[model samples]
Target chain A: MIAEKLVQTYKVSFDQNNQELALAGSMRPQRAAEMADCVKLLETSLASIRGTFYVNVKRLVRLNNVAFHSLAGALLKAAEERPDIKITIITSSVIGWSTKKFGTLTAKNPKIVVEEYDSEFYPGQAFLEEGGFVPVLRTQTKLTWKHERAILPRHGLEPGMTMADICCGIGDFAVLVAKEFSPSRIVALDHSKSSLAYARQVASEFDIGGIEYIYGDAAEMLLEDGQFDFVSCRHALQIFNKPEMIVNELVRICKPGGRVYVTNEKISQCLGEPRGPSIEWTYEQLSKLFADFDMDLEFGPKSYQALQRAGLEDLRIESFMVTNRDGDAQAFADMIMAWEEMFAGGMSEKRGDDAAFVEKFRRGFEDHIAAALHPGGYAGWPVWVASGRKPR
Target chain B: MDLGAGQTEAGEFTLLLEFDMDMAGFTSNWSYCDRLSTYFARMISHNRSDSLLYSNLFSSALNELLETVYRLHAPTGSFVCSVSRNGAKDRIALTIPVDTETEGFYRDAVVVLNGGDVSPRYHNALFSDGPLQPNIGLLELAVDYAACFSIEPADGNAIRLIAELTLEASAP
Candidate 1:
């Protein structure tokens, strides 16, 4: 059986690594049998439709890692036994090699392959390997932490204050607010289930209380009227298809004397020139949309007269530049390499030889990351962190 | 259950039961209430079961008391009630009325109701001998009587009753 073959190979190659000669020299019949047994166990377990089993094993030969093969084979066996059980195999480094060497096990049952990846390439693949949860991105982590630090002073967050966080991706900021402010209740709303799952996991791991994770589109979530002392969003307003509807929802949930904080990164400039036309067009549309809701937008020094025109009281705007200088140069190189891979993928798909475009993007991204880390890059790609407060 | 009228400076005031009496009867009749009391006593004597039912019944009673306050207080114009569940206890604290006359009435009623099963806790101090000075301590007594009236059935009827009560109280 394929399951037996997988276990035999797994036992034999358990300690095998990248060295081809060592792997060739270590191959033995007895070791193969042990690997087969391991595969059999996995296959048998998967064949049963009851419980869920997860195994983490590393140090398999690059091409024929038995753990990956056994998991794949077991998934196939499980599907054959009962097609309803959901099986997810998340590999970080060797998935591509396994798929290529073993042939696609998910071909017969496409749904069984929830996702497959090589973690070394997909930085986000770290999430799947770590039980399908990833720590918030470092930049996002810092942003959230800074927002937490600014909450009490900027928004007057205090214990027993009811608060709502809209577009709360993974609820990192929401968890911080729940823990630090000890709000009477903190409703963390997100549109993505994956994000909400991570948020729930973080809340559970930290034993943070008084936070309710709500899943749905933020604009459509039926929030209780006048229930929150403050409604907040972090760096999510721009991506909202209907920014105006979201703004209105924020205001609707806020109490009569409550405040609404909209935190967003404004891309006003690109590549040391005025931002691309597309970016400006998007913002203009956004400005017009918000105007319909009587919101006064305060963009950097070129503050819109519409803010005053909309009769917004206490309108304020601030800008800050974030740079990643403390990290090693290799990190910058790795980032550049990742972007190169992305460009390569797109270029390859189009069958176009755009090596010059690839080089330009690589150089730009590398310089940007490096400069931002260096004092010289501080002014480049400056992020506008602006917030406005709604009147009581 | 009848809640007796009490003398207040404003005038005579009466306590009204807000839940559907007919629904309460359908769930727990008077005879079944006696049976529950007997079974509970026996169960306690034998140590055969945990007192989860007692705890659940107490929680249900408290929820009902708060729900009544949330509904009637606003309508009567005495005080406002905002029912929030994320707090430590299932209870309602009436925001103190600014008017001295109204505050006096509310405080006296709460003081009288202190230490009862549904004891009233005053948000503000009460004036002695005020027009609203009917002992709210009686409110707690009323809850106890209502708790005793709750009956248990052979099936999962008690759980269903609690669910129904919770739904009624939490309905916006």
Candidate 2:
């Protein structure tokens, strides 16, 4: 029953995304009869969906048995009545009670199932999510921060602005921003729970507040709309299969006139003085190998086009080369060495590259590291930084 | 199900919140159960290991208890809701005006909750073909939240119902 003002207390929407019906907010109806409208809507929606109907309770923060029994009971009836359809309830682990409570419905029938969202949230980023890669991620952030700290101001980051670091690997950049520019709030989101846990631990160690490390998928983020003044997604777009989708999200969450900043790599453009030819061959091979996995290693220069397609205004596009000559030569070399280990020892193996190809790949990284450590040699990893303001 | 049981020691827990208002004003709208529980959950969950997760879990548990009282209690008297903490545990204490029928309902539900596992009962009640169970909230707190329930006589005709839980993944 709709109240006089509005029953804005909760919402149930038939998303039509993967046949998902999203339920959110506090749904504490007094009795089962009070949920008649919801039950009717759900039943009607079920008729049109495919063989599998998904109930996305990931954002459903609160639900009483009266409401649950009604909605879930309707799903159960659909399961028995329409045997062709499999009813799946998607619960978020973030809400502790969701999985356990919704899981009970599966017992009634095998066709009804409850699956937690976090387990499969991150797709195509498994190489970066390995436990060993965590330390390397921090080292990468440390090396990149030297360039970004200076580059951020030109991209429209200002003091007290609210920012979101999408795909915030380990969240060190967010901490850096919070300490330097003093954002009123920073929502640092990454898909890996392990990465987020480490980020929280680091923030706690630094005794810095205001950085909210959240676990989320960048493609279909749970973050609300137009809630941020500046949105910086660093070194992330290239990793995702669809960079434009993420750019659109960055624009969606940015307030009008607020800027969306991004950083991505042009892998083949990564240059080194010593063993230049070998490094070039390896990086070019690396770019193709990444393409095999749906990741875009050469998405740096394409950042301009991605933002433009997303319909952002006042585009500012530039590139920064994090070279060994800039700050810490050893640190930069350390980052290159870690990348070699991951690319050769980990991702290359997953790609089923032959011993000769992997050996050749390892040689290029070693040469880049050699260039970084060489006294007179120069090694550079170029990152493209781009920003566009959401039109007012 | 935390009504008419036994008293918790005064100094054993540190009080966090105390909201008092007339019962008629509180029960005038069913939405108050949701509003008050959410407000209390946010107020107390800031220091938890995962504040958003803790608040979401706590608000659900507290809303069930408040809804139970809203359904079964007398029409008039002061309603008191208090939250307290001792180490990792949080206690939601609701002192509500009760009639003989409502008093018996709480006492009986507590007995059923203590005698056996409430999970099967909760599921059965959840999907039962008959009319909805009035004590579903009690079984929910006991089973889903793993909350421990207790009750003691409060001032005048009121009974103090308490549900204590360790909702945090770890201490703050």
Residue pairs with backbone atoms closer than 3 Å in model 2 (clashes): B2-B161, B5-B151, B6-B151
Grade the docking of candidate 1: incorrect
Candidate 1 deviant stretches above 4 angstroms: A1-138, A268-312, A325-355, A373-381, A385-392, B1-172
Best by DockQ: 2
Candidate 2 ranges with C-alpha deviation above 4 Å: A1-26, A45-51, A82-85, A159-162, A205-210, A248-259, A304-315, A388-392, B1-18, B170-172
Model 1 agreement with the true structure over B70-158: per-residue lDDT tens digits: 22221222222222222212222223223344334444444444334442232111111222223222242243222221111212111
* lDDT value, residue A284 of candidate 2: 93
lDDT values, one for every candidate: 0.40, 0.83
lDDT of 2 by residue, A124-146 (tens): 67778878888777878888888
Categorize the docking of model 2. acceptable
Write down the TM-score of model 2's second chain.
Answer: 0.91
